[model samples]
Target: MKALRHVLRATTVREAIDRVPEAFYERFAFAFLLAWLAAPLLLWWVGPVIGTDITFLAWVNLQVGLGALILVALRLAAHLVPPRDVSWRVVLRDELPLVLLGMFLLLAVLATALSPTAEALDGDWYRRESIWTFAAYVGFFFLASRVVSGVLRRALLAGVIALALITCIVTLVAAISAGWHTDEGAVAHRAIAYFHQFNHYGYLLAVACVLAAAAALTVARRVLRGGLIAVFGILLLTLLLNDTLGAYLAVVAGLAGLVTWLAVLRRLHVTTLLLLAAVAVVVHVLADALGVGVAAEIASLGGDMVAVSEGSADAASAGTGRWGLWMITLEQIAVSPWSGHGIEGIASLLPGGYGRPHDEYLQYAVFFGIPALIAYVSAVVVVLVRVVRRGRAVDGITVCATAAAFAYLISALFGNTMYYTAPLLFLLLGIAWAGVRAAGSELLDAESTPLAEDRTAPTPII
Candidate 1:
């Protein structure tokens, strides 16, 4: 009765908002990201029985739930706090990429509503990347950019590496137990791990491997650096176990981007460059010795390239059947460039039972219109530019985020986004933006302070 009486006299909404520190929502947002990362792994245990579609839907709902919470917290804070507050001003100044992403989401909603075949809010039954999911993605991005700092940043970085390590270990065990071959006498090439498809798992491995490698190169602490290297080696091994050529190319592109960016900043030593080359050679040799069949995949890819170059009609029938599908997708986009046919619009146009265009950029244009694609691509470009502008003031985690983004974008050229992996991509983007803001603030403080009085100069953070 006394507890009930006290509850009846609880503080009003405004008073409660005043009592709660902003850090609470930040912590909550951090937890939301962690949960999103771990959900697929947990669901993997029962994925065989329940089906991948269910797992995908579960992820979508989780994103919407947690993302909505963070958004609500922001609205409450905005209503109670003054607009001119330092933090509010900072957010407004550094939220351009997020703003562009929100624009894409709004345009997606319009496309969906105007869709002739797709349901108003819900997309197709297969991969339902509806307006609701895109809204959640934007909200998650906003919250991450706002709060990913200090300890939270470190935690998120560690989480990504740890998840990669765990996935590699489990995948190796499964492959070994299966004798690395199917009963059909063919090699069991693709290591699915926790994802429903080999390609989806490949996307995650690509990003994580790149991020881990970049972090290992720049991190100052010896133990952490060694651990990251080990994680990178394991991820590379697992990647080789699978025959996802797009993933292999993505890793190379990501590392190249990382090395090039660091060289531009004058942060990478000649010795570090040699070490990276040596590591690549070692991984290649190891994969060859283990009979990973990567060479055969590469040779096949090369043959396809040659076939296409010679103008062979067989190029239309080449491996992966992507050439013809791409042509069809281009034709469809030409028909409806401004307002797309809606989510999963390519399904009806595809031949040979293909669903998606297998290219993320084209898929976006097919589903949500050319404007939406431009907005999303611009957002990604803005993220890279923002981090680059931070220069040497950026930290090791930000460097990892940049490489991961490169890996994801490159891989997306040959693959579509998965519900499980897209959130991780957005999380890295948010972290990258957060790092840019923090680095800018550090530079600002250094400039404001006198040289003699500024004991803490803006040195390159590792």
Candidate 2:
């Protein structure tokens, strides 16, 4: 017992953290945010110019390069600013998503270990690799949010908007050069920049569009709002060119959530909807002039949606193959209802030419078993519920975050977004935490600080 007590002690870890200044957490958070923002640009600009597609490698480089920089910044922050301690309760509360994510990852890893792959290891790693990557972002961003005060949350959101703007710029350049095709396409569009597959790019843009729109709606500064709105237009055009129906549906769902929230608050009215319509019309005219074929895309998206609903095996199905693949996948899952084969377990079992489950909920159920799927959905549901329950009194940013999350959830129904736009959405989740936590801080400041005698009553918290 004595030896066990010594071995289990947390003194060493705490001592290491203690050596670092507490004030560094906020800076570390910002530095990490900046690193992520730099990654897509590194891939899109540097990759094409250098004749390489190192999108995944760029992600890895940011983790290594920026991670070290953050460590140095942490040391500097500790010394330069006053140090304070954070309680474990705070971490547990603010980082519950990550905690739940860790649990899911652990289950996935264990499942993979227990259910060894019978087939060759060619693509057996895809599912497992995605889960690992997802876990990394959740853990990294959760920690980033943990140390910083609510003060840095807005900066983090702005960082997201910056990423969206850059992505839109890269996407527009790539689409213009590559040109859009009305014919059948590959799994991911062929012309996407900074992402491997077309759907991946589509999903990213769709989520970014939501982010940009949210920012445009709430931002007080006209210049920033205009910039965001412009970015949203660019992103919308790119999404149209990609021709991903799932992404389109997801983006609309997110927008609806935002609109509903605004309407509930009496903020959404005819002028707002009319302005949105005008923006869409202006973008459509611009797209038509640019020769991107916006009208064809609208027709194609409608046709694809109809096919999916009717389960028609047509030209669209030849491209995505989602409806049919899902049918076979559900049958496969029925045999082994629980304790699904781990990781890329589904790929080998699936019929040839079908990429993945294509649905995240189905992927979770077939890959990690039903329990993991429940947990996965629960985590997302918790965020949506939390944001909704935060009430109209919270703030515009928080409401925006909720809208973005809802849009992503709607998209997740169609793709393994956990592998793509999900990381971005997870970052938004962290920002949401920051927004809520910041509000709480203001409340704390009001209660803790002593009021001057002249000001008998404290200022109302608007």
Candidate 3:
């Protein structure tokens, strides 16, 4: 009778879920994440080489969609087998950003259904950011929020840091050995590394630098903190070598965001300030040595502005050729204010055979309409605001994740949504979401109790 009662004690679905070992969920999350992270490296090693368009796209399509499909299937099975009593009110109040993401996905589907071209519905051959991809992204995000926690979460972050370090080190070695100039005779060739696009490489470095900087600042272990500082130095140096202006600006913006948040929480100390100042000095010195100093880049930008102001015919050709493309995209957005053309829909409309708008906000509006864009931006803003306002000062995950997201947003202004980089940004955002949820207290506001008053609190080394 006692055994029967024990078995029957699992009345709620939440209780049934709790019956399973916690290790099971952690292992499942780790396996899924490992496979996803390894996909790119595996492709680079044995899969299709660049310029073999069809085979490369086929491989990428399979790699990107496979893990996501498995995750979706697992999530569905979990829901079907043990239905939990969900409080819709609580979800609505607490998970507003996630709800907004869902709305964005739905709006994207609507846009895809009403797409004018077949390419828009299925995505173009090169950049296959179809509706399916967006759906998978959203699913992965929601699942990440559930499974990624505690030790597994820290492991995932460490893996990401290691990946970034490996990539930057390899790129630096290549640049040193293989002449740093490209065929077009540019001063210093941009570092594309294993990825096809230099800007994509820039995106990775920019985010990694912010994460490393945050970890170095907050981690309590002396050796670990020193290692993180070294990692930050390498990342910053590689970022300078990558030499993408948008990425440079992104790193600056991200660091600024991190410092500002720390200051707001009253966590900024003299040591941290001195460390940051030293980092800045090192960056300037390295930039000068690399022959891609700040002054040179600024002069180039000024020259472009001057040409544009003087109405030069070739002004549109200067500085990434983005001015003309942005103008054209704005005009098209006005035409289709409600129903968008769908993913990669504006390719035909764009001049010079360009496939993307070179701007993420414009890309979102063009592909999925204005409402979708608003929903996506709103979700990001809400998550960012929540992390800055409510996350505890000792929570390194929240600090690093928020900083990385900020960097990505700033970089996205000049770079289009990339298939490789977009997933990373979403993952960081998801981790941030999870960190916010795991605060375990209603008194979670960082501003309510400053770090100075709570010096003995434990800090997670993530």
The residue pairs found clashing in candidate 1 are none
User: lDDT order of candidates, best first?
Assistant: 1, 3, 2
Q: Write the per-residue lDDT of candidate 3 for residues 1-462, one digit (tens) a residue.
A: 553455468887666544444335435655666556666565555555543432253345444446545644544444543324545454454567778988998899888888756764465666666677777667556545544444555566676778789888877787888756633466446556566677778888888888888777766676887788788888888877767788888989888878877877747655855775687679779768767566677688889889899989988766778878887788889989776777787787777667778899999898889999999999998888777767354366667777887888898988887666776777778767766653345333332333421232212111
Query: Candidate 3 — which pairs collide?
Result: none
Candidate 2, residues 1-462, lDDT tens digits: the string is 553454355367544444443444546656666666566667666777777554355346336335634554544443443324644565455545655766676766566566656421222323224444545555554544343343455566666667766776766676667765546544344566656567777667777778778767766576776776777777787777676767877887888778777778626645445666578678768766765544565676677778777767573363256666677678767866676766556776666855467887787777777776766666666566655655544455555666676676677777774333556766667656544543333322211222211122111110
- Please write out the lDDT profile of model 1 over residues 259-318, one tens digit for every residue: 889899738855545765676678878877777757787888889889988989889655
lDDT of 2 at 59: 47
Q: What global local distance difference test value does model 2 have? A: 0.59
Better of 1 and 3 by TM-score: 1
Assess each prediction's global lDDT (C-alpha) against the native.
Answer: 0.72, 0.59, 0.69
Compute each candidate's TM-score over C-alphas: 0.86, 0.76, 0.83
Cα RMSD (angstroms) for every candidate in the order listed = 5.4, 8.2, 5.9
- Candidate 3 clashes: the total is 0
CA deviation > 4 Å runs, candidate 3: 1-27, 48-86, 182-191, 303-318, 391-394, 438-462
* Candidate 1: segments with Cα more than 4 A from true spot: 1-10, 46-57, 60-66, 69-73, 76-82, 85-92, 116-120, 123-125, 182-189, 269-276, 438-462
Tell me how far the alpha carbon of residue 112 in candidate 1 is from the true structure, in angstroms, after superposition: 0.6
